[model samples]
Target: MMAATKRIALGAVVTALIAGLAGCSGLGTGGAGSAPGAGKESAPGAEGNSPAAAPKGAVNLIGDGSTAFTGAQPELPRAKRLKPGQKPPQFVVFSWDGAGEDSQKLFSHFRAVAKKYDAKMTYFLSGVYLLPEEKKELYNPPQHAAGRSDIGFNDTEGIRQTLAELRAAWLDGNEIGTHFNGHFCGPDGGVGTWSVEEWKSEISQAKAFVKSWKTNTPALKGEGPLPFDYDKELIGARTPCLEGQKNMVAAARTMGFRYDSSGVGNQVWPTKKDGIWDLPLQLVPVPGRAFETLSMDYNFMFNQSGTTQGDPDKHEYWGNQMRDGLLQAFDRAYSGNRAPLIIGNHFESWNGGTYMRAIEETIKTVCTKRDVQCVSFRQLADWLDAQDPATLARLGTLKVGQKPKPGWTAFLAGTAPGKAAVGPVPARPADQPAGKGPDGSGD
Candidate 1:
């Protein structure tokens, strides 16, 4: 179905996002403990879709390159232009915040799960994870003491392990976006109060952590560098505490960021803000309540238990609460309007590991279902961009949980002139199409 060419202004489409309304950044509920929320927060950050550059049999390296311009990233299936008259696939994005393979080993565990389901995820890597703890002082965060990080830095072994996972994850076609350094939140130097310059400083430092990990960490002196170029690879992020997004978006747009997942939204089609995609965390139906909850585990905990450690007896119930709510949210989009579902998580075993179980089960339950594509934010943005403006404008017309009247085929039956618009695919550096089996059998 070729699409119409209508466009809608963002302010008219996303009423949930109040301009200049502040909310706290960072959820601070993963790993060990949950911190108090910041006093303020706000919604906040293009065409993300570019085809994999097919390389011609060799690798190219940039100057002082900690990573190489490797051939087309393997294991990714080619995303074709959706044919006209076809319904959009149900896109479910499972993203991790403060991504690290810590003592819990959740990162590695989830990697295996994503592989089992042929799913791709976004890992928002906190830069300090790559930076050795001993070198913390090197990070000069704006407005704070040098080397100070709300999220603890890593040791050499941890860094090495994280690097290995990140390398493997990228090679497996996952995205590595920044979670920035120093997971600071709240009014006392929380990211909510940072200026555009400070946010830029934070971003630069985040990149510095990943790009210069080896230069700073002596133990990694001889080990292999990260697999991909950090400079060109990073294009999106989620702000800490979800605060300072008002300024973060401004800073990110200038840095070529393609998307930002910092605010809360209803289950609706996304639109642009600050010249990039504003893919916010959404509010989903709470299973047993009339009200909805944020599509994140920490928020569930915050509401249910007031912190990461909730009541032991209700842990199972809490897990089920999240699982059922996410599935409920999925059904509303899957069966109703066909809007994309964005879920955020951490690697911690919060509330007795119930949330982990919920996420894992959700993955197994949904990814294999018909018309479902568990993709990355980058992929989602690209898909949205490739679409016709009129089609998107029509999609935006369907409010939260509202189905297209007279059915999808009839609603999308009309086509304007021209070929079906296609999303941009990154040109690969290799001859073989990505995700081709090593044996040359596409299987």
Candidate 2:
């Protein structure tokens, strides 16, 4: 999504400008080494490491982008077989559009909860966040923006800071994925309203941005931070506003994305005729707003007031729904229900202060108590692909009160740090003196 006028002279400025244009910004675990607690240790195929053969009887807990509500999946009947090898549903949490301090706070919040139970946190960032640090060449966007000051997008300085912090977190071990910028169906004037072509451009550009960082930058040199070390074309996404379009899916696959988390539990796979992996989010519903959207789950977690598009209420309600909804969903799913509990949130909706505190409360009540497995999308994918013959049939009758299988906790705790890199990673170029320069007054 670069401006057509001209390329920026300095990489950093151009990067920031581009971010301004894009309003850029910026998971879970599952399977054998799965569980909310599984995150404490390392798994072979997790993050960027080589895939280890999954052990027998491993169950993955999955989640999706930021969203959690009460009585959302009110009627999911259980699975039939409830077999040992079958993968459990996921809880994939997305970082709402682009990157910011909220992104970091959300990541930190998720990290705290996941770590408390040793669960993994899945993160998706906007490419704009990486521009100031990774694309710092004079020939980059920064130069162009510096020259014109307003020619491009991005808060070169702010994004730079966020990237530095994110890099550090990834090194500590986290799943960093891709959340498409300007593609989801957002509020009026939101990025989602962009044309299909613009949406395609957005997705491609974000992927390209990350790909460049993994290969072109010195700071990221060999550290293999997430979303980078793994598939150069990490194709996971949460549509803005959870809105899904047919053309968007086609564009995503074309751009080399392999997964889409926009689908809801009520919808089946291939719902759109495309072969894209439909990682539908399972959402809960608020008591009064049940009639609003018949498609996805109604969220009671956010108070039903205020000007927020998603929740009419501005009150932070994640704490109220976390336990009752999660336990109820788990009970329904384990008892052979086909419905998966899809929890979600926005960067602004669930970060720091009350939101963070609420999530922590939920973790203590739900994840730590039962067989919950907060998992990554890929981990869920792997588990789903390995289901036994009778597993699907047993969803409706699975029992509760059984001791969660052992071994995953050990795996989570036993994880060794991935490939070592020398020296500390770099700060955003905007922070460096190199970033201050002669205004690109033009040629």
Candidate 3:
């Protein structure tokens, strides 16, 4: 009798495994009238694990945010892809708001670091930073020092130079884009006493300035092989401060923007109100407080107070933490069929802290892990397009500026790969448009 019972139990276990793998799930079948085998399946929720779900992919791991505080993506190409057992992909970007000497140095450092990774960063420059002309004076007088630069603050010249550099970076396979002309909060909020309309003008001015650069630079001016591709020029942009959502989106579309990496973490698509794409920032973990809420503010780098400032002891500088958070978020997304993690940064922090160096080291370490790909914003946008049409369709239907839910954020926090499985593996073919191969280069 004992032997016969043992054989029956083995048969039942095999049957359950087969049924689970087959995805034999049902609705309203796990309650009072629950089926005999239904109770064994995992529960349903943001953190739930359905027995039928497919395994997550590793290459799907990602991080999004400003590279200015970290480094420039254009400089480093090899560091773009994350290999198996690697950390994550940190998509750093920039916001070119102030024309201070510190800001310029920050931008230069950003370019230098990105070169090391062969990645591209999205640069958001304001109109004031690129004024039509820097009203220079032959005589050095205190009169010209009123928010005016005796040195490099010419609107037109500054913007032209900035664009020229960005164009060069682009020619080298980097990325570029505009920040509103006025440096402020959303068009609704004022920045240093500027009004909404004034802010709008700043964005318009910045775009126009960039247009001129496209028409003037020898490498990028006309239809040239390296810099004159219409498709190439269409890929640059980040909001001034991720402000003026409605106005910024509408203006960018009117100005012919192809994609906008302004939003962070939250999945978005071209809005019905405006056709511009929203590349949201990735959710980065706070170094010491890896379980807290990720801040949406762009100035988190400038502010040294609170959790936004970051923890340096654990190598959790803003850049490291952000990148780590991004990896965790992407791991969660890959596991749950969600999208990539996005984060943004600025150049201000580069003036002092080890932001740039930290970012470079982190990228060198993380991007080569598992299936992570260190693509430019444009590349990411392209990969996004190649997603299953059904998935893209669902993404498209989502409204613009949809904030992440608390439950989802909590779920992402739980999936951090700190010494644990990084999660996911690239089952898709290498030539399938997302990444290269295990070598981190295209076949």
Candidate 4:
């Protein structure tokens, strides 16, 4: 059981084994029932996930027609630099690992939730989710057998449903990122031990799975290809179990990846490491608990029941704890330093599906609030790129839960004493690395 596993310290928080246990694979039955506020029409004219609408321009198919070159993706928001002395918006990223549609239909369910709230998210797709079980040998995971995948491969039906969701998600302005393949963890032959070259191989294979799904799954060959060219669409990823980040970032930076969410950090502004944004999962309040945990369902579960299926009697309490913890994290960032809140989750029904309910409630509450921008990691990176380097450096100086003492107007205006006048870019925290928070187990 996960409860019996040894714990690892992540800054002030302690987390359990970094295994891919939370996103364990299985194609179960039944669709996800309507989430709270499901029937509400999408905000204004936001596009719902009705079906894959034809691209605005020509559809030039790529390899095996698994993906295509659809013209500029619809509804992608442009990133604008903040006006001088203007306070930043409260950015919240709701991301998923091993994203796919199985019996629970979570991929489609959350797509509706995002549209209803006029929000965009990052779906870290596990490549094996699109690779059929019979074709598992096509994957060549470093240090592991060719056909071996910790989370297992998918069936043709599963692949078809997942592909449909991916197509609609991209067209809806959501970002489709990779979660790599083979949820391998631990010290032996795990991602944490793989070399930089091996990590690159794993990444390429992950992209290949998405690029050639049609050829791998013959039954789905005639289906419409994924709307966007995956090579360009995929610019970020979260490693399984949040391990192997040091080498992963090195390899990803060379591959044109702009950011990575494979590490743990405090609830402060993000900084770049090795030329890539190190946007990590953060430590948030745990409600009544004395210590905080990573802002992820798996960590909450580990500390609460210490098992995926905990005592049914306390399910509601556990769910409330997670929801409140995340909201608490949001409030501080929203009201304090105004740093972006990066959150991670999985398509799971753990603990009687309580976590799912908590996440939906969190989304409904925060995404609709004033000055809050519930966006994907890709969008956050874009916004970050648009900011003046000096301004970003100033923002990083604000500690966790610490607001600007001089107020946003004077502080950001470069009028405060001892603050640089938004000219030269100073060294960012990413250059002098800090202690990373604990890695959450599973996806």
TM-score of each: 0.82, 0.54, 0.51, 0.86
The order by descending TM-score is 4, 1, 2, 3
Which tens-of-lDDT digit does each residue in 366-387 have in candidate 3? 4444444455555555444433
Of the pair 2 and 4, which is ahead by lDDT? 4
Q: Cα deviation in Å at residue 85, candidate 4?
A: 0.2
Q: How does candidate 3 score on lDDT?
A: 0.36
Q: After best superposition, candidate 4 residue 393: deviation in angstroms?
A: 0.6
lDDT of 4 by residue, 58-170 (tens): 79899789998867777775677777898988889999988888777788899999998988999999899888889999999999989998777888877888888898898
lDDT of 1 by residue, 64-180 (tens): 445667755665554544455567788899999888765567778898898888688999998888777678899898789988876768777677777778888888778899888
Ranking by lDDT: 4, 1, 2, 3
TM-score: which candidate is best? 4
Error of 4 at 57 (Å): 3.6
Q: List per-prediction Cα lDDT, in the order shown.
A: 0.71, 0.38, 0.36, 0.78
Measured with C-alpha atoms, the lDDT of residue 139 in candidate 1 is 87
Error of 4 at 153 (Å): 0.4
